[model samples]
Structures are given as C-alpha cells and as structure tokens.
Target chain A: MVSITEGKPLEHTLEQLSTTREVTILSCNTCAHYCGTGGRLAMDHLAFHLNNNGVTVVGKELVTKVCIQEQLRGCNHTKTIVLMACSSGLISAKEAWPDAVIVPTNSTLGIGSYDPDTGSATLLFPFPGHETSRGARFPSLNTEAIR
Target chain B: MIMTLRRLDYHALIAFLPRDARVLVWSCNTCARLCNGFGGKEATKALCSMLAEDGLEIVGGEVLSVSCFKSVIRKRLDRADLRMMAEKATHLIPLTCRTGVEMMRNELPWLEIVEVGETVGLGYLSESRGAVLTNSIVEMLDLPDEGIPLSEVAEDLGLFLGPFER
Candidate 1:
C-alpha cells in the first residue's frame, strides 16, 4: 500500500517559507514520489522555484523513506524545513527534530494502491474522514508545479 | 507497515466457499508479513497445506512483493503459468490486507475473491516493540504517546494475532 498526498498550492507553500532565512527541502522518494508530491523531481523543482523567487533553498534531501524515524534523522540542520512527504513522514520529522520549524506542503489523503501500467495510484482505502475520497484517482499537481 | 487482523477463522473461511471450489492462495510479503506473520509466503504455504488436508482442490499458491500495487498483481496474473493457474481456480483466497484483496478483485473479476484479512491502520516497525499503530482509521483513536503495539491493538479488537489456523 502507498500513502497518498497532494501538494499544497504553490502560493501557499511560498507564503509559508516567506520569512525563513534558509530552508531545507526534505522529500520522500517512495509513496510520495509515486503520488507526484514528494520526490527528487518535485524537490528540485520546488528548490529552483524558490531560488528564483528570492528564497534561499539551503539543502534538498531525498530520503528513500522519510516515514521511518531513523531515516529522517539525517535531514539538514536548518531552522525551517519544507517537508514534501505525507503526514506520517511529517510526524516522523517532528519527532526527530522537535525544535525545527516544520512546514508541510502536502495533505495526506490516505493509503492507495499504485498501478504501474497507468503510472497512477487510486485512493482505494482512505484514512479516517477521507471516505469520500475513496476510489478517487491521483491528483494532478502539475498545475501547481513550476515548470 | 499496514496493520491487519484475521477477518475469519479457518472454519468460517472454508464454509464460505462453494462445494466445488478450486482455490488459489495469494499472499502479500510486505506490511501484512510484518503484522505478526499475518500474510506472507510462509502463511500462504501453511494455508494451502491446510486446505489440501481438508480435501479442497488447491490450484496453486502465489506470493506478491506488495499486493497493494494493482500493476504488480496484474503483471503476475498476466504471466502464462499464473494465468493458467488462475484459470483452473474458482475462488481466490487472499492472505493480504483489504486493499490488496480489493485490487485482486478489480484485476480478476471472474474469480470469487475470499478476503481473510481486515486492515486496521498504518504503523511503523519498532526495534523494541514490533509494529506500532500510529494512525488508525478504525475505533482505536486514543493510542498511547509512543503509539500502541499492533498485538495489543489486535487483542483489544478481539481479532486473531496471525494467519488462519486449522
């Protein structure tokens, strides 16, 4: 099963990072990657956009699985972190770095099953309160994504 | 890891299938496996053996890396040997989480799918305490600060700890 999430609006993410001096972008390359929210490509794109918009992206860490608390411990020691993983990953980061300012860029929809042939994931079994999203297809973050 | 519990006992499971049922045992090797050996290669083998002893026609036993991926399940089902095995089967017994069982249903609509696992919530593997439930979609919302152990959660829910037993 895959943990599914949708990227927050670009404007909202930028606003959250507006006051930060230097921020680290932490992305998970597994389920989030499959969901097109948190991955190497997404991280790099976000970093580039942030840099172009006068924001200093100090670091970009692409963890294989950020939900694992141990794996999340290696994130850059920045004051602000723009986390691009699911809520579970965000919780792990919070537990790992209690003092750091963690900003989430994705909304956890729930768990899903991926279809490699279609390169898409369906929200088969949603988390609590996300029952309406069950059977919903993967979100298109392409609009919010910076080219 | 995704936490799951045995949804049916062996007796209940056997009685649910048709009299002339040809069974194909399917299992997931990831989260379900971590759930106290709930679903995995070994679990599949054990269930298959038990069914055979009960005089059921066991078509075959298959193990998936992650049954939650429809593509993975579909790819495996498309294989010539697997397709033949599936063709010979009337009912699919899945030793996987509910999501995995649902994917099997979507891919193989022709066969009657038998779900034996009930997915509870998501959890992480703990070095000292085993699998711990962190996010639950079910009733167990007030988990401990460090999260509740999957075994404890299963026990509290009146569910089986592992694979079906004969």
Candidate 2:
C-alpha cells in the first residue's frame, strides 16, 4: 500500500491557489484518506482555514479512489480546483479537466509500515515522481500539520 | 474505498501455523488489490500455489468483491461450500487490508483468521510500488489511542522486546 507523509504545508499552497480566485479542495477518500491527507476532516480543515483567510473556497469534494482516472472524472470544473490528494489524483484531475487549474496541496510520499501504536509511517521506499513540491512559496504557519 | 495493503511474509505466516493445519486464504479486488496484497482471484491463486510449495496445505481460496465489508463476507459464508471450506480449514488468512481481516474476523469468530498483510495506512498504487499516505491518518494517530509508542507495540508483538519479529 502507499503510505505517505504530508510534504508541503497547506498555507503554502493556499497562498498561491487562493490568491484572488475562489478555489475548491478535492479530497480523496481512498489511500489519501487512510494516509490522512485528503480525507473529509483534512479537506474541511483546509477549506475552513482558507475561508477564514479570505480565500474563497468555492467547492470542497471528497473523491473516492482518487488513483483511478475513471473515478476522478467529472469533478468540480471551476477555474482552480485545489487537489488534496496524491500526485495521481492531481494528474487525474488535470486529465479530466485540462482547462481547470489543478493545484496539489499535499506532497506525495512512498508506502511503508504504519504502527497505530505510533503516529508515524515508516516510508522506506518512496514512489518515484513524488517530487511534487511547488517550492517554498510562503513562510507561514503549517495549517495542515497533524498537531 | 481506502486501499492500503502489505505483502505478507509467507515465512512469518508459516512459522505460526500449526503442523499440518490446512488453510484457506481470502483476498479482495478492491483496495487490497491495488496495495499489492492478494486482492484478486489471480492473486489468490498465485499465493495459494506459493504457500503450497512451502509445505502448507492450502485447501482453497477466493477473491471476493470486497473483503472489508462484513456483510459481503457474511453473505459469502452463507454458501454451503464456502462455509464447509472455512469450517474444515484450521486457519483462515486474509490477503487484504486490516479492515478486510476485521470483516473476516467479525464473521468467523470461531476460526483462526490470520492477517496476511498489515493494515499500514490508506493510499492508492499507480505502479506495483509504494503508495501515497493521507494526512488524516497522522491526525488520527495524534489522538490518544492511535499513537504508536513503538516500544509498547514492540513489546506486545515481542518485536525488539526479546526477539526480532517478522
């Protein structure tokens, strides 16, 4: 299974994605859900934080099985849809709506062992193409951190 | 819909099984299949063959629609043939996520249901490699009960407690 840790902070992505336009957050309910990245609560957290910060969150969706392109089709086709899922989910969103600006909020990591006894996931081998860092855009509080 | 999985160290599974105890393996084609656990009929077949080579008698196995659904598994168990196989087998192994194991365990409390894979975290697979984890899981673990004290888990599983565990 794919086990990943959050890469970039939500504030960083929001700084770019929420700049003057309304943004929608697409959360994945499958692996992204299990990883705790794009689940309902995480998506809600992002939306709430962004909305509070003057970023108009136009839409918020929880996508099931984000990796499957078929499942990701026909989602919010607004100008910008902030993807709270993995690289695959981002790609699927992009594929489905080429015109819509799909921005990924989370950084993708590889699969590893997870001990519920501990709050950490052991990501030994990482999946290639996980360099989804949009680069350090804004020095801000880590809104999406699991604290 | 949360697809997370781990490859079972057939060695570890074998080490625990009683001598000559026949086994029945179950897998799902939903999330576990994507995580590389035996989630499909093909995967179940191949795993069965491999275990058979290891001197373990695998009676039969199946790849159901979703092994995590307790109702689904209960329905499958309703079939006389499946019920007979499960009853006859000494142990039942689920080549699925932890939830899938729970599904089997919930239905068949009397049978010894071994977990073939660890329910690590939830994520999807593009290739046959690693998957992406979610932020919600970390937040969930941040809660009191979900935290892994490492040492305690190690001690409970006897891993790094007195011996190196599988």
Candidate 3:
C-alpha cells in the first residue's frame, strides 16, 4: 500500500504524514502482523521516519486486536490517526471514532498463505496494473516464444 | 523466528490413546483458520496424510466447526452411514487449536485427541535495519533441522494460491 501527502509522493508514507501533521499512529497487532505490516516496530519505525522528516509524532498504540470493538476505546484523541492495518480494519476503527481522520498506511491485500520458509506474506496475486518485475539475474523470456 | 506453542492439554489427550490406535481426524473452521493452523477440509486431509505416512490407520475423516458440541458430534456418530467407520475408530483427533481442543475434551472426556502444527508469532527485532523475525514453538516436538527457509515457503505458497490484489 502507498500513502499520499499534500499531493506529493514520499518514500515512506507514514513518515511523511508524521512530518506534515500531529500524528498518532494506531496499529492492530493481530492480522496486521500476519499481513507483514503493523506492530510495535512498524509504529516506532514510522515515528522515527516522521521525526527525521521534522514531523512530531505525539503517541502510538498497538491494540491487541483493532478489529475488536473493546480495544477501540484505548485509542487516544491527540492527533490524526495513521492506521497501520488492513482496509477492513481501518473501516472498523473509523466507525469507532467518527471525528478522527483515519488514513490507511497499507492496502487491504487478499488472503495469503503462510510460507513455512520465508515467514513473509507474499501477495497471492499481483495487483491490477502492477507488472511483476523480473529479477535482474533471471533470463527474460523471448516474446517470440510467447506467441 | 516463528513462535509456536503446543497446547499441553492436547498432548495429554493424545497420550490417552492406546498404542497404534485407529483414529478419525477432524478440525475447526474458525480460530484455526485465523491462526494459520490446519482448518476445514485441508486440515482433515493433512491429518489423514500424516497419520497414514506414520503407519496409522485413519478410519475416517471429517471437518466441522462445532465438533465439540456433544449433540452435534453424537448425531454424526449415530448416523447409519458412519456407524461402521465410528465403530472401527478408537479415537477422534480434532485438528483444532488449543481452545477448541479444550472444548472437545470437556464434552468427550474419554475421547483421544491430538493437535499438530505450531502457532506463529512475528515481530521486528530491530527498527534500524527493518529486520523482522518469526518464532514458532511446538508443544511437545523438536526441530530436526537448525533452520528452515520460511521466506521461500511463504513466497511459494503465495504464488501457488494465485495472484492477489494488495
């Protein structure tokens, strides 16, 4: 997923937002981790990313499960919410706080299978309009062979 | 660093079985799904495959979310079509997580149970390098190999499942 800031692109969207606004990053510690995003470190990294960019991040929280309604009460109302969770999770969080401007830092990817080897979640499919980049060392298939 | 914890209760349930007992396998369709443990038909299939490979006869296999509910499980057991299979089996091996395992154990105190797979917990070890680690702990099992390339496995599984939108 990508983040937009003031109509300009930034290398790390979370860092960019922290720099531009008073931000309180909220993460759903459950499924986000499964999706390879969200957690204490992601929150800290984003905070640091923002700090380096001159954005002041006031606070953060790694809710046990953001999808659970009870945990929503723990969110602090100090600044705009930069949610580090799946799209479905963001919707739930938004419902809990109608006044907060909730911005999603990650895109909602589809169900992923766990690779016993890598411990990372690879998207089951390439997103629409996104071309899979061939590795530098791999031989490129000839167009003629395709035809 | 995949973190896995084997539920001790599950081990106890399995230990109750007689040596080389014929068993039926089942799994939950809920929490196990979220935990990445075997669930649904896939879970039942995996248990059958593993048990067969280990020289155990899997008399029958089924997948149900409420297998622990006595009324439900009992009704299935009483079915005329499954009477023979149920009679031949010495135990029921539910492939559910620790929670489901406990529920089943409470309802069927005499049934044998076994849980396989590990719970995976992940976190970043360092923010400076953006290094993440997954720790998996098996309840009563040890790894024969020092390390397994989990990233490759995750990648292959993702690709095998087909392309997904981010």
Candidate 4:
C-alpha cells in the first residue's frame, strides 16, 4: 500500500470533491491514533492547507470515532465533508450525511505491524492463497483456523 | 534542520557499531512520541533492555524533550552531565527521529550518534468501534486474505530475546 501524506493528497481530494466555499474536515482520533497516523495532526494540517487554498473550512472535529452514532449528529453540513480517517470511516460518514460529499483522505491498506527498530508501522501485505491451504490441509482444525 | 519524511534506517546505524560496544540510549519525548517512534519513555526503556540483551553494555538511558530545541541548555547546563556520561559510553544510541539525531551530531561534534526511528508524520488510515483499526484495509472491507500473523508475534518476541541464557 502506498503511504502518502495527507498534504500530498489534500489538493487532489479537494478538487475531486469540488469544494468551493466552505468545507468540514472530520477525523476519527481513535483509529488514526492507533494506526500511527495523524488523527489530530491531520485535522490541523488539513485546516491550514484548506485555508491557504482560499477555501474556508467551516468546521473541524476530531472525535473518538466518527463511525459512532453519537458523533454523527453535528457532522451534517451543506459543504463537502472530508474524512481524514480510513475508507471505512468515509463510508460511515457518508451514511450519516447522505447529501454532503464524503471524500476519503487515506488509502486503505492491509493490516500493518509496528516496527520496533524503525519505530514505524510496516504494512503487513496479505499473502494470496494462504487461506485456501488451511481449510484443505487439516481435516479437523482448531477454532483458531476458522477465525 | 531538513524536514524530510522518511523511515528510520536501523540497519545502517547498527552496521556502524563496532562488534559489541558499550552505548548510551537516548530518547526524544516530543516529536518521537508524536510520530509513534522510539522517543517515548516506554520505548526508551524497551530499547535499553533490547540493546543490553544483544550483548551491548548500556551505560545509561535518558529521555530528553528535544535535543535540538535545548541545544544551548544541553551544551551549557547539561554539558558537565553529558561529558561525564560520554566518558563511560562508547557511543550514543539516539532512539529518536532523524532530526534529533542530526541536531545531536551538529551540537556535539565529537560524540558518535546513531538514530533508531523514522521522521515521517504518522498519517491516519482507518477506524473501528471497539478496536482502533489503523491500517486494516482488507478486514475493514471484508476481503479474504491471509490475515495478520497473530501467532507469529510471540515467536518473534522469543527470537528477539534470544535462547534463554541459562
């Protein structure tokens, strides 16, 4: 998975969303923080980027999780709602505000592992066809196999 | 300082070490913590333990806010303390980002420095209700793939610790 900065993709996503006047950037602190990505930092950086682009970012919120029902209430706005979390977050945000344009800032990558030596999360690329061998190999596998 | 977003080069830094030498573990608490690197207090302790197990003598370990930000203070107030610590160590293993490493290099021209983490600004990937799913794209979309190797993590830790020193 390509790990590009939100700043690199901000202009493109904004253009695609066709955000003219005001925009609302919403970030989920829970997921992004755990992932080693910018949960709060992304919101601040994006706000700065939008303001510099001559677009007025009306609202910015960094909730525990944007997918949750409680935080979905105040997210509804007439302007485009940009989600700085993952693709799943974008889907949930879109579900809440059907009318508002939901744009995703993060490219969905597979499960990643934190590298202790480098102090960065390394994307754990799933090996294709490894799942098929598991079911076919053993007759009666353990509960772990099913999961 | 040049602000370039790149992962830490642990291998390169390790290669610079001479066989098995005494080293001091230094961590940055601010930027490194923000980047999810080895600048945090917990990470500094872990690094010291890991290094000690690897047959390297750890003289001491310290967690500074920003070595560069306090370069003047580090040079003046902390100079005697640093000099005393430097005398006991063979090298300064900076468990900080590249910027911190660079700052230390410039400030202490005679001191040997090594960096342990990347300088990239951690970016957001995903979110889940109970679990904070940062980088799980496949499971998030429910696509079938060999999921995360939860079983291997224990084995990896065992390997990291080395054969039980009996």
Candidate 5:
C-alpha cells in the first residue's frame, strides 16, 4: 500500500555495499517488485550495474516477499544484505536475520512528489503506509556500518 | 511476494470451450500470486467452483509453486493424481502470467492451454488498498481499460475468496 519514488545514484549504493568481500543483494519480488524499484528484472540490471562498477555481487536473490518472516529466512552466509524493498521489508529482514548487515538500495524522495522534509503522512487512494522518520531522512547506510 | 494481477473475463475465456470439454486449472504462486489476479491455491479452487457452477467439467486443479518454471510444472504434471486428471482434461486454464501460460503449453503439448490473467506488469500490494498496478508495465503493454482485460473476467465470475498466500 505504501508508495515511494527514489532516484539515488547507483554509484553511491554500489560503493557502500560492494566492499572487499562479496555482497548479497536481496531484491524483494513482491511489493517492491511491483513498484519497479526491485524485482528480478531490476535486480539483474542492478547486479549488472554493480558488476560494471567494480563491485563483486556474490548473489542477487529475488526474495518472493521480503516482508514475510518465512521468506526472510533465506539470507545467505554473506555479510551484507542490500535491500531493494520498502522499510517494512527491511524490518522483516532484520527480524528474521538479526546478524546480517542490511542496507537499502534507494533513498525515498517521498510518497508521490512530496518531499520528506515536511512531516505529514500522505494518504492517497486508501493505500497502506509504513511509519518512517520524515523530513528528507536518509536510511542509516554506510559501507562500514556492517553488523 | 506481491504480484500485480488482473483477472480475465469469463465470457471471453470460455467462448471457445467445446462441448464436454474437461478443464483443469493451473495457477502460479509467483507473479500471479503477488497480484490478486487469480494466481494462487484459493484462485484455482475458486475457478474450479465457478466452472462447475457454469456447468463445465473441472477435472482437477493445483496451484504450482512456480508455474512459469517449466521443470516444476512438469514435475507437478508427473504427480499421479494430476497426471491422471491431465490425461482426461481437454483444456488447461492457467490463471498466471504469460510465461506461465507458455510453460504450461510446452509441458502439455496435447492439451489446450488457456490464459485467464494478463501479465500486466510487476506490482505491489498494500494492506489497506490491495493491489496497485504500476504505470511502466501498463505503458509497456499498451493496455486499454476496455475490451477483455482478463482480471475483469474473474471479477465477472465473482466467486473468488482470496488474498491468500502463494
């Protein structure tokens, strides 16, 4: 039900997650897939982009539904998990695999064209929403912020 | 996972059904499952029920974990009950993406494979608003709102009890 538009540079995302070791990208094939942010086709393109950027993408997984606890259990032994899904999917992955370092691939510009800098929940078309820190918030992401 | 699915209209879907044609439903829990477009176990059951009510013979039905995966669908067809039913089934109605319909067709070359859901595009699901179809795919497919956009077919059937998991 949540909608997000993001256009963060792929170069930055690659530099953050693709470190010395292999990086595993968990592309949500469900919600985010529908949203065109992450899906099999998008993940494949991302992997292609990352590989071209000198990042070693060990694997790209199309998690059927990253929000589901059961599907979240498929995390690999790889150290990093790059998420292409929304915040809800990230939370589900965190709960399911507490040890894996998670990083979001996109920086949400906001629902529709609204900037996150102004704090207000936008409800359009009865879409379900996820609670997030508003006001141009950046998801805590760093190449060294691995857990 | 959430898939953006639209149902097929029943009137157009069954127009070519021959007399005494035995139908077996097959749906994928992949893209079709993501969208409420009649792509899961519940959809298959509901389709079978609707066909039965319409005086059609439904031999059997199953929700394949990945109907688009040719090998998996072949394995499903290899099941004793499914194989037996498929032997007698004259047609296969797949409530799945275009890939799924083709895979089913390849798997069973003799049976007539029917598509009940148009693979519009990849999509998202909101707990509050249900299925949301993105624009990229809509533009890619060049779909119009009228003239048998498959989901409307299932909507016309009006027997689905859904939002079930893949």
Candidate 6:
C-alpha cells in the first residue's frame, strides 16, 4: 500500500490547466494506479478529455514510481505538466523541473491498504485534516466521462 | 515514513499462538524499520532468538525491503528454500504495516497471520527530533503545528516503542 489519493473532479482539473499550453501528462503508475486515479488509463482518459476541450497535450509520461526523482528525469520539460499523481509525486515533479508549471489532478487523502480481494482501497490512515475519512473504502473513479 | 505502534507485548503475543505452533516471522525493512527499529532485520533476528528461547518452533525468519509490494515479497516467498520453510510453518508473525500484512495474507492464505503492529499514520524523519508524525489518522490525537513526536504518541497511547522487549 502507498499514499492513498482521490482524483479531483475532471472539471476542476481542466480549470486548473485552462490557460496553460503544450501540456504534458505525468502519471504515477504505482500508488495512483492502485487508487484508479493516475495510471495509463487515467492519463489517456484525461488526455482525451483535454484534447477534445481544445487543450493541446504535447506528451504523456507514465512513471512507475513518480515520487522518486530519478523517474522524472526522462520526462521532457514542458510548459505545463498535468500531473496525475499524489502530492509527494507532485513535489518531486516540481523539484525536477522548477521552471515548468505543475498541475495536480488528485488529492492525497492519506495512506491506506488496497485489498485485491475486495478490489477497493480502504483509507486506514488519513492525513492531518482528513481524519474524518478513516475506514472509508473507495472504489475506482468513474472514467466514462470528463465530469 | 509510516508510523506504527506495537499491538501486543511479548506475553500477549505468546498467548495468541498455540503451544505447538510452528511460527514464521516476516518483517518489513523500510518504514517500520525507520520508526525506531519497530520492524526490520534487527528486530526479526531479535524476535526469532527470543521466541526460540521461549521454546517455540521458529521455522524461519525473513525480512523484505518493502513488504507492501507484491513483486518483492512474492519473489522472496516463491524461492524454493523459503517456500519449503513456509510450508512447514502453521502461523506467521508479520512485523509490518497493515498494507504489508494484507499482502502477506493474500500471498499466504493457508498460514494464519498474527498481527502485532498497529499503523498510526504517516510521518517524516526530523534532524533533531527523529521520527515525528506530521499527519495522524488516529482521530483521538490532536496534533500541534509541528506535529507530535512518535515516542510521545507511543507512550501516551499505552503502546510499546521500538522492538518487543522480553
């Protein structure tokens, strides 16, 4: 289990990257993948949505572990990075390319365990202010639409 | 870092196992290790010795870098030698966070896993103060701006700190 995160509503994410051009989607395939927020599928869905909305997606980089600085080395420095990872991975991306604008698509809820048997991740340990969300089980984010 | 506190003491832990239990100890060597030797190679070795001295059948003890990851733990347990030892064991003592324990349960469904650690929350290592829990999931705890020290949390909650002491 890793950092448990939730995807922000697609509208919110789009609004955050509204003015940016030549956007690069940086997705974490580990924790965010398990959370159903920032994997290959999530990145592609977001990219498709952004493209249809007239936002140009220049490139897409899928990292196995985005929290590690070395994983971000291969990502090209773009004008705007639509990062589909947790807060930690976002920080790593920021540190990797300080000049580029980083836009996060998810909120780091806290740390939790993913039960493959149940196919849902339980929020066992939420972050400081998110204490009320303990023991909450989250299913995969709906990707049928950009809403 | 993932902060954890001891769920049971040595005596309580011993009571959980039967008299003829063939125990296998599996520990996580990452976050739990950084949480002041709660679970690591050193703790695994110490627990094995202690359990052996107490007359338990210590089939084997192993420590993985990150027990939470399926690939890392599956590879270790799939090894011929470890598999043989695991087959002989009836119970497993997991010295890891809840996620790691879930991974163990998924991997080894036959063996009964005796959980002995409770995951408190996420924390970071401080230069001056050691492991300080910045964010806690324990709703009862009211944290300060700088967060509370893990040692204080452990003591306040009537939980044991570090490795299990006999």
DockQ, in order, for the candidates?
0.36, 0.07, 0.03, 0.04, 0.05, 0.17
lDDT tens readout by residue for model 1, B1-166 = 5778887888998888777899999999978887888889999999999888888999999999899876678789789999998988999998888888888888888899987888887776654566677777686557754677888887888778788788
Quantify all predictions' global Cα lDDT against the true fold.
0.81, 0.59, 0.48, 0.48, 0.57, 0.80
Q: Pick the candidate with the highest lDDT.
A: 1
Higher-ranked by DockQ: 3 or 5: 5
lDDT of 2 by residue, A12-107 (tens): 775676456688788887556656676888778777777777878888877786766566656654688878776556654665667887778776
Candidate 3: count of backbone clashes, pairs at least 3 residues apart or interchain: 25
lDDT of 5 by residue, B1-166 (tens): 3233444456655566776889988877755765654667777887688778778999998887766445567777778999998889999987776666766777788898775554443333433334433222232233322122234433543523133222
lDDT of 1 at A2: 80
Candidate 4 on A1-147: residue-level lDDT in tens? 122112225657668656377777787775454443446765777777777778788888777655343466655454577676644455556555667776666644432333223434333332233333221211112212111
| Runs in model 5 lying further than 4 Å from the true structure | A1-11, A14-64, A67-147, B1-7, B140-166
Better of 4 and 6 by lDDT: 6
Instruction: Name the runs in model 4 displaced over 4 angstroms.
Output: A1-22, A25-79, A82-147, B1-20, B30-39, B50-56, B65-83, B115-122, B125-166
Q: How well is each residue in A1-147 modelled by candidate 1, as lDDT tens digits?
A: 787787888788889877876888998898888888878988998898888887799899999877666676546758888898877677667777779999998888777777777878778667767889898777554548535
Q: What TM-score is obtained for chain B in each of the predicted models?
A: 0.94, 0.72, 0.51, 0.58, 0.74, 0.96
Q: Compared with the true structure, what per-residue lDDT tens digits does model 6 show for residues B1-166? A: 5688888999998888898999999999877887788899999999999998989999999999888877778789789999988899999998999888988899999999999988887655554566666566777887764667789999878888789889
Interface RMSDs of all predictions?
2.4, 9.9, 16.4, 12.3, 13.5, 4.8
Compute the DockQ of candidate 2. Answer: 0.07
lDDT by residue (A30-125, candidate 3, tens digit) is 556544366776567667766666666787888866644456675685547877765445645666676877767764433223322344343322
For candidate 5, the iRMS in Å is 13.5
What's the TM-score of candidate 2 when only chain A is evaluated? 0.76
**Angstrom error at residue B21, model 1:** 4.3
Compute the TM-score of each model's chain A versus the native chain A and list the values: 0.91, 0.76, 0.68, 0.67, 0.67, 0.91
Question: Candidate 6 falls in which docking quality class?
Answer: incorrect
Q: Model 3, residue B58: displacement in angstroms?
A: 11
Off by over 4 Å in 2: A1-64, A69-78, A82-147, B1-8, B127-130, B135-166
Of the pair 1 and 5, which is ahead by TM-score? 1
Task: Report how far off residue B88 is in candidate 3 (Å).
Answer: 8.1
